[model samples]
Target: MIAILKTGGKQYIVKAGDVLKVEKIEGEPGALVKLDTVLMVSDGSNVQVGAPTVQGAFVEAEIIEQTRGEKVIAFKRRPRHDFKKKIGHRQHLTKIKIKDIKVS
Candidate 1:
């Protein structure tokens, strides 16, 4: 089975046993997270697509770790203005493994 779920202002395509990184979620390792904002679910031929989100459908996942993404550098400069700025950023992220997809 395959499913599309939403979290942290983003959407993802996933299936059971798949591991992925998403925006930081508040939980410790091994925490079970239920994602109820499912956009679509499919099992080969049969597909269910929600208007916004599927009712009574959810995906379960286990938090594997909290991590940070690769650093991104932002730099700005002005010609002949003696102005320069440089900033670095790393997005907080969560590693999660999909456990199950269920529709009621």
Candidate 2:
């Protein structure tokens, strides 16, 4: 089965045993996190979509690690004025392994 869950203000489509990186969440490695904001669930032929979110539907996951993404550089320059600016950023992220999707 597969499920669409919301976390860190973003939605992800996931299935059991899938490992995904998401915006950082509170949890240590190996911690169990239950995500209840399940928007949709599909079991091969049958699909269930929620009105915002499905009631009594949840996705269980195990936190694998806390990490950061690659740095992104933003640079600006003006040749005549000799003005230059540069900025770099890395997003905090969490890696989680989906254990199960339960719908009642």
Candidate 3:
């Protein structure tokens, strides 16, 4: 089965055994997280869509690691002003593997 779930203000299409990187979730490695904001689910010829979210539907995932995205550099300068600013940032992320999708 395949499912669409929402977390960290984003939606993801997931299936069993799929590993994905998403915004940071508060959990340690090897922890199981249940994502219940399921928007849609499909099983071959049958499909189910939710009105916002499907009731009793959830996706189970295991936390693989806590990581960070690549650094982003921002630079600003003013001509003839000798003023410059440089900044860098990296977003916290979590790597997870989908274990199952259950639709009741």
Candidate 4:
């Protein structure tokens, strides 16, 4: 089975046992997280697409770890003014493994 879910302001297409890195979620390692904003569910030749969301549908996952993404560098410069600025950042992320998708 496959499911499309929304979390942390983003959407993802996933299936059971798939590992994913998503925006930082509030949970500890080994914790169970329930993503309830389900948009679609599918089983091979059968598919169910919801209008915004599927009622009584949810996906379960296990938090693997909290991590940081690779650093991103932003640089800006002016033609002749010698005005240069550089900034670096890393996005916080969480690793999780999809456990189940339940559609009622």
Candidate order by decreasing lDDT: 1, 3, 2, 4
Q: How much is the lDDT of residue 97 in candidate 1?
A: 99
* Alpha carbon deviation, residue 69, candidate 1 (Å): 0.4
The collision pairs in model 4 are: none
Candidate that scores best on lDDT: 1
lDDT (0 to 1) per candidate: 0.97, 0.96, 0.96, 0.95
- Residues 8-104 of candidate 3 have per-residue lDDT tens digits of 9999999999999999999999999999999999998999999999999999999999999999999999999999999999999999999999998
- List model 1 lDDT by residue over 1-104, tens digit each: 99999999999999999999999989999999998999999999999999998899999999999999999999999999999999999999999999999999
> For model 3, which pairs clash?
none
Put down candidate 2 lDDT per residue, 16-104, tens digits, no spaces.
99999999989999999999999999999999999999999999999999999999999999999989999999999999999999999
Candidate 2 regions with alpha-carbon error over 4 angstroms: none
Clash pairs, model 2 backbone: none
Candidate 4 C-alpha lDDT tens digits along 21-58: 99999999999999999999999988888898989999
| Candidate whose TM-score is highest | 1
User: How well does model 2 score by local distance difference test?
Assistant: 0.96
CA displacement after TM-score superposition, residue 63 of candidate 4 (Å): 0.3
Listed per model in order, the count of residue pairs whose N, CA or C atoms clash below 3 Å is: 0, 0, 0, 0
lDDT, residue 47, candidate 1: 98
TM-score of model number 4: 0.95
List the candidate 4 regions with Cα displacement exceeding 4 Å.
Answer: none
